[model samples]
Target chain A: MAVLDRDTINAVREGFTRHRLSWIDTLPFLFAALMYFFAARYLPLGTQVMIQVAFALSLDLALGYGGIDSLGHVAFFGMGAYAAGLYALYVSSEPLSGLAVAACIGALTGLVTGPLVLRARGLTVVMLTLAIATMLHELANTSAMKPITGGADGLFGFKIAPVFGMFSFDLYGRTAYWYSLGVVAFVFIICKLVVNSPFGLAVRGMRDNPVRMRMLGVNVTARLVTLYCVSGALAAMAGGLSAQVTKLVGLDSLAFLVSGNALVMLILGGAGRLYGAIVGATVFVALSDRAAAIDPFNWLFAVGGVLILAVRFAPQGIVGLIADWSQRLGWVRR
Target chain B: MAAPALAIEGISKNFGGLRVSRDISLSLPVGARHALIGPNGAGKTTLVNLISGLLQPSSGRIALDGVDITNLAPERRVGLGLARTFQISSLFPSLTVAENVGLAFEARFGLDRRLWGRVRSRPEIVEGTAALLQSLGLLELARKRVADLPYGQRRLVEIALVLALEPKTLLLDEPAAGLAVSDRGALLDLLLRLPEALTILVIEHDMSLVFRLAQRITVLVEGQVMTEGSVADIRADPRVRDVYLGTRSHG
Candidate 1:
């Protein structure tokens, strides 16, 4: 975590100095930072929003940049949460170590399964991923692993160390929000750099025409596998963050419902665009939280209706919608 | 003995029971402008695909400069000095014409991973792409997205992309497939003026362009080489007239 913070801050500072950073590029980070700062000061929402955003970004990279539509991403997220929870129970409550264990476990799982899942394209890939996630969910619910995973009860009573041995996590939620925000920011920057690189362009080319990319001598399967593992690591990191802040982990974290919601968030924000992930996560989580506060079961219906409308009318999602409108108004042009 | 730039010996390709290319044998010598002309479905494009490594021939060998490149991938063939332009314009639609050309230069120059740097600002890459675009009469459209270009302009961009690779051997799959008569003439003029070191094998349906550009013409019929000769000989051949030229007489 310390290394991540230093690297992220250094990269951000360098990026700021080197390029004339556009508002669109800087807007999401600023918005996230401001929201976290205010929420830490005024609210008690913990780090749920930050964790959701991180998960959303990971999903966007997988589906958008890597051009693999996954309906089983929550499998990695749940695995990470459980791995972190189990590590905390058996090894240490230190958040950093737990996060590391979670990420490694998630990455390994993705590496093993990614080839099989990625071999199939389009809806078959989606179905296979969904099945994988469901299988994980069921396995997590088994009695054999219940001692560590807690089965139906899930893992509970996990603890987190103070951020960098300085500020302890307290009821004020400052420590939790800042820690998650810092991690999210770090991962976001890394993803941004990767997606903008030549390797990233190759992936985009694959999306446009796989045959052409293959003809270009790109090892298509290997690239997809690498992306899958990275995405899994990021998703796991988000899960670890969630487990640390909430101090509990559940089987539902790996459920298809959770994964489906993340996909919906990605599409609602926009695919291919990184900022779309954050926007989708923010809107989806905030709206769900708000509507659920008013009506639990029916809010999902409203969300579903909105998703349908979004798919039909604004297929590019919110960021795309805004970009289009801005272009029309001559306020900004790409 | 120096082998030809491209040697296609006894090459055959089949789709199901249908033979698209049958035991086709041809050798493109260095600096030669060889044209392959046939009616539609005469296997002209199929032969190009085999030579460019887009499809593997079912039989025989493809050797480049005496080195066998029969099983090499398309990009590897490009690396071995084999570059091709497609029948359809295959430019990156979202990219500017210069950027589209630059990508080909970048690929051939092994600079695909030079991320975090200003690729478009690279002096050599920019200059080379610009020069190629100018040669193809696409200098004005350099900064414009390929999607916005007219079909003729887009075709020019595609040829420029192939030229930017600095290939020793070039395969053009109907370079003037879809263009106005004037644009076709302009393209043929541009082709004639290219550096003589670039050995070219062109598949063209337009007889006037083929007669004007090709040093030698190979007439393909029913997936086999029906005849091969100079333009004047091909024009006078009774078999060539009966099979290919005769069909176009009504038009």
Candidate 2:
């Protein structure tokens, strides 16, 4: 395939521009943004606000578009958090600078490990990602990087400075919430542009059939690596946002449970549908919060059972279920 | 006048102790419609696979248009003007018939990276794909997805896909396979009407279609070339009669 020219790129971007404000197209971001804004005003301080949204989006990209069943995505998220925390504590307190460092570190880690994980297909890919996440979690718990990462105690008390010297991060949770909301909106737009690009088609085609894409002269590995890096950077940005909001970074972010939760969110939302990620994230977090209010220890079991049922009865996730119902009702047809 | 469009020199492929293809060599000159026929285990498909670069030969060289393409990847071979159709219908089922053919046009034109533009909106790709599909009697089904099309229509779309590549040499494996008699005749007629500058190699089990379309015939049996000649010569050969036609009555 030839390189995309100006006309083609413009055509693609234009295609997305037309659908930018369509009801279904805009709902995910709008809903998520509104919820974050409201939560910023109402919720108690010290909440890990951005973690669910970031995890949801990253998982969506990896599994939905990339067709990779990654259970190690949280590794990038946790690494990003730690990287941002380290930058805030040591390099610079500037939130933007911390975010930049996190993104770079996340992307680099993804680039280095993506090929090894993606080389395997189906169940193997899932298993490999799980292994990687587990390893990262163990590494974070070790004493080797104790001074920097805080080892078992984890990194804490790292202050997030203003946004480019313009907005100071207040203790009332207003600044962090808006900052994260803005970042999510920006990343969502970028992801939308990417997944709608020719690159997106290629990725989807890879999901459908890698052999066919290769026969069509698509560099399958390169595309996978590119996607991995992009996802990594986004996940890292989310992590940085989480670190800034929560004022701490911990090994729990890298744990298998965290990765598993992200996978559940992606699948619960719908594997390939972009908005499914947001839906999944929202439902998951909301349900967890509600269940915890009732009984904290038993919520995991309840959530796990619901997740199993979702996979069994609604394999396509909630979005898929809704689409199926809509089709049955003749509401929309493709 | 020049080197044959494709020349396979003593190509052999062995799978462990099983000899899949043994000392197979054939030259297909420009415009020649050469048919390879064999029984159940005759390695006809295997030979096509080897030539198409899906499988490597244990020993031999394959040259296309005087260029050695023995080690080239299948897609690169396509870039070098070699195209093949699968025995079973192979198509992008989710894509529209036009898009399926357009992919080949895009590949040939090197426009694969123009990802954002609507593929069907490209005038060149659309016109060329439409014309090819029209020629293959698939114009009416152009807007339909391959998955939604009938088996015969899908096969026609597959032919259109290969045609869209504008290859110098076309390798069709069982193009008439699973088609109705009338559809088989139409496919054979399409093959016969192909431009004389294009070299065609076909692997078929249908003796009538083979005799009707092939300018020359090569018979393979038990992974070896049993015989090769014109249709009449092949028909008259006792060895071919004993191995293929003669043995059929018992079944």
Candidate 3:
């Protein structure tokens, strides 16, 4: 009774600064680090997986946790690729700075478009995101923008500086692997902080019952806009890493296929959970690589088959399946 | 004299050609326990919607603590110490009860934007969630997910979630709906135990529960206040019996 009194209420809240240690969070990073060492021959594939993981994570924040389903999340990725590519060519060719610049552009795009796009509900918001990404894609494809964007030919002719003025991005993609790994770790950390924070719960509450959230004094649109900006920035960093590693920004970077692939990867992995993106990225990228090597054009059939199976059997996702098993085994309570 | 907890003056709302609320007016002084009761389609929920800023009144003003809040956004009204619950249980199905109840403190304490800290580790949130749950006799269910709870327990959680915000006024739309007899008893006891600082307006079909919980009753029939008086006065009124009480029996 005493505790429920208004006087006992702490008007100012603190203690949100500490980062608690969790075995679950470190497991993915450990696996990524170990793979970099043990799977040296497959660094290129591993690197691509890491980038996908990073990109998928960004989408997970928007679509999974925030419930802002974006079909064209590749907008940020494309913007980042172009931003980093252009920055490398014209500015300094510094990898970190270029990545930062791309991230800013991505964040800026989200900030600019968030209020407008998030204004729509449900399918309309998804369509608006798709439209925005497509418009950017078309703009980059146009001849008028070719001088800057390199148009249909894609952006290249830029040398990415050796990461941190030391490690060269060699033919083996060793440098790129480490760099992308770091980005995944960093992005995962950011998402961990967000999804576990009060803001994160508020977003989830809004996702479930927006009217209840409104009655609780939360600005749902404003909160989602902020999440969109964060997600966009993280995704841009993923794109920037791709540009830095490959030294090429192609039309495919901003293509609709890239966005669709990300969505599928997220769904396959499971949405909302932090580890969903990681698992999804690893499985999808590895499978896609293997399938593409065999069929090239017809590989999507294999991917489609797996997706249908996943939807039916593991709708909550691979991580969710693991969780269910653990719970059933009395490893965790319901 | 410190201004009524809530006051609505001649508020009316129309949808297309349909009048959902007509020149409806009600006021709740500080610490008032009122019930808004009516048959189905009598616009009880409509009036509540208008008060909570979910639906705008075509005319008239709503005041909270002497401040005109008719134009306030629904979310903004909450900042002014107004809160509500739906007849249908609206809760974060996947989140734990502690998380759901902690959401209010999360927003009110301005921690909603803190993107670095885990919600559970924060002492303020942890202690506040525990305290609220304890006071409501819901501590045992704190860690349980809302989706896993029974319907009766979920209703109780919904109320606790609303009360977590510590709003001065609470608008409950059918708080006891679909509750078993024992569940209704628990809800009644919890409501009775609430502090005097809170003012509650409950919309209910359960006449017995309303008779026990609410001190003042406002009866609505077809978008109009059919009668308003003390609980005993309304219970004894022959007109109320003729209009509402005749068919609406108590257990």
Compared with the true structure, what per-residue lDDT tens digits does model 3 show for residues B1-251? 58999999998888989988888889999899999987789999888888889898999899998999999999899989998988889888877787788887887777887777677667778777777777777777876778899999999888888787889999999999988998999999988888898998999988888999899999998898888999999889898787777876666
For candidate 2, write residues A191-231 as lDDT tens digits.
77666554555566677667666555555676788788888
The prediction achieving the highest lDDT against the true structure is 3
Q: Candidate 1 on B1-251: residue-level lDDT in tens?
A: 67799898999999889999999999989999999988889998889889888889899899999889999877678778887778886666755666666666666666555435545345556566655654565656766767888999888877787777778998888998879988987898889888998899999888888888899999999999998999899999999988888888532
Model 3: share of native contacts present? 0.60
Per-residue C-alpha lDDT of model 1 across residues A68-101, encoded as one tens digit per residue = 9898999889989888888888898888878889
Off by over 4 Å in 1: A1-20, A33-46, A90-92, A97-121, A131-153, B113-128, B249-251
Better of 2 and 3 by DockQ: 3
- In candidate 2, the residue pairs with backbone N, CA or C atoms under 3 Å apart (3 or more residues apart, or in different chains) clash, namely A198-B115
| DockQ of each two-chain model | 0.22, 0.28, 0.44
Over 4 Å off in model 2, which ranges?
Answer: A1-21, A33-50, B109-131, B248-251
For residue A249, what is the lDDT in candidate 1?
Answer: 88
**lDDT of model 3 at residue A289?**
89
Residue B150 lDDT in candidate 2: 77
Comparing 2 and 3 on lDDT, the stronger one:
3
The models' CA-based lDDT, in order, is: 0.78, 0.77, 0.86
In Å, residue B39's CA in model 1 sits off its true spot by 1.5
